[model samples]
Target: MTPEDLQTALARALTLAESGLVAPGAADGPIDVVAPRRPENGDWSTTAALRAAAHPSGRKALAEHICDHLLTLPEVAAADTADPGFVNISLTPTARARAAIDAACALQPPRGPWSNAGSGPWSDAAVDPNVIGALQLRHAAACRERRRARAAGITTDEADSSTLDHPSEARLLNALAALPGAVDRSRRLRRAAPLVTGLSDVADAVEEWLSRCAVTPTIDEDITARHSARLVLVRAAIIVLAAGLRQLGAAAPERI
Candidate 1:
């Protein structure tokens, strides 16, 4: 199904819940459906009815009732009603992947960064560059120290090296340090979009690249590099989308 179709179905489901057609408290909270971090959980599962069933009736009956209503939707491939009223809805993998891609593509460019330069909702004026610089230097030193310790046959904590000491982390820090000039360059690029249509096309190209990467079963080093490059664009898109949604007083779901 398309993103709009899935959204409409979700809206109808919410309306049904609001009208007491579905169990009470079933549509509440940040996420009613508990999406699994790993793909193995069959896309999305929810214990909303199970949690709501604690009222007059028990969970089992409530779960069965909710499942009955959900089974009417074509997008739902299968609805497994568990004991204590848990309804697990599984969608077709192809459909779910398409929905994800569509959502990513719907994102608009961020409100000009300068719009948030001063004070507004969600301001970042308190950020201290000196403190950030100090932290980066200390983190770089710690990484060097960890490498030395490892070379000396010490059993250093792997977590620190894996995260803070990673080469990518250092590169990211360097990038942030040089972001002011980069922002200026990006603004210039935005203005020159007509003249640089080929480069402008790269941003539009990101969504398709992300979709391809998402469906790949296994990625080798070369493939990984290409995916990583595309992901940088994808992340920028996410930040822009999140910022826009926040401005519109809507909550963007956290990325998995």
Candidate 2:
């Protein structure tokens, strides 16, 4: 589901909880959904429970109550409360898959509030240069890997016998899942989008994908489609990164 979708769902769920819990109007305050740093922590998390716990019912009961209400939503497959208050949300598998594919197809950056010339951390012009340099190095490494595979006389047209299975590929998906939060934060914080957090996530994921994958468009068609997917994801990364830089008054160079 999209950010707006999830946000709306959470709001509705909170509304459902208002009359039943210690929170008379628990849904009155602002709500936030977070992308966990750990992949297994769940697709997203919310502080709604903690927010409501400040009333009187306390954290545990509020967490459970909110989670129960959240579970009633169609988009959410599972909702569970972690200790003290955070409510972790897992979207239905189909929802997660659709979100990933949608992100890949769109591959566009959402507009951010801050610009490079603004008085913010991302105002520096050098960040993109560093990012571009790293991207160049990665591209060169990919070319070299392909060259070696070719020198050993590996055939381009052959298909892999194995199904899709790669750690880096899995990591890439996790990286994509984190992008919306990053974009929203960029806008909300009025900071650069390609800052250390989101941009680094994309870059590190891309770097890992490069090191782990063994296919090349210059030679072989990626039988598992993993390589193509990685390329798509990385392209989205660069597009968003560029948008962030440009908004921040930094020029995104065509070449590093």
Candidate 3:
């Protein structure tokens, strides 16, 4: 599931809860749905309830109420409240896989809200050279992943959600799903830093997944469901990183 999808679910739950809890204008602004700092917390989490709660005493109740509604979403497998009004949510693997495949299928055109990035007389005066270098490395890694997947005889058509059970895979999928939200936040803040950071974070997740999983089996006969799933996950990450780089007015070259 994409971050926008989760954010919409959170907003709906918040609206429903607010109606009963007397929280006025609670969903007025963009609600930030993010990867939890700790995976055990959930696939994603949001602090909208804490911000929406009219009073400190109401935060926990509002969070719980919102989660009650969050559970109703088809994509969400579980939803629960953490202390101080954080809503942690886990999406079904099926949902995440479906979204990842969809993203990979549309990789060529690249997705948007990219219009907000503008046809600017852009400058690098405020840019971080380290961040740019990191992005370049991610571009190179994605290219290598593409090559590896091809060598393994895995393609986008083989991407099956039923086999996507690896923890690292889940982390990478969630990071991909969160890209649009990261882009939006960057646009809203009028700074590319958020988007740069998001891209870097996603790259880190990709590396982590790669380190733990073998996309290319040592033997042809060893190819399995996990390999196919990993291939799709790689493609999805490639799509997202390329799109983010484009948004920053950087070229995401095939050869880095």
Candidate with top lDDT is 3
- The TM-score of candidate 3 is 0.84
What TM-scores do the predictions have? 0.38, 0.62, 0.84
Q: How far is candidate 3 from the true structure (C-alpha RMSD, Å)?
A: 3.1
Q: Write the per-residue lDDT of candidate 2 for residues 18-118, one digit (tens) a residue.
A: 45454666676778876666667777788877776546447777778777877777767788888768888777644554554455444443323332234
**What is residue 80's positional error in candidate 2, in angstroms?**
1.9
Off by over 4 Å in 2: 2-4, 18-25, 54-58, 104-132, 135-171, 177-181, 184-190, 193-196, 210-256
Q: What is the lDDT of every predicted structure here? A: 0.39, 0.57, 0.75
User: How well does model 2 score by local distance difference test?
Assistant: 0.57
Stretches of model 3 off by over 4 angstroms after superposition: 18-20, 101-107, 110-126, 188-190
- Best-to-worst order by TM-score is 3, 2, 1
**Per-residue accuracy of model 3 over 1-256 as CA lDDT, tens digit each:** 7878877777777666644463677776678887788888878889988888878888899988888887777888899888988999888888887776665454446244453454223332455667766777877787897797797677656556767767787887776666666666666667776777778888888888878878777864667777777777777788778777776677777675
lDDT score for candidate 1 against the true structure: 0.39
Between candidates 1 and 2, name the one with more favorable lDDT: 2
- Candidate 1: C-alpha RMSD after superposition: 15.7
Best by TM-score: 3
Q: Which 10-residue window in model 1 sums to the lowest lDDT?
A: 156-165
lDDT of 1 at 73: 71
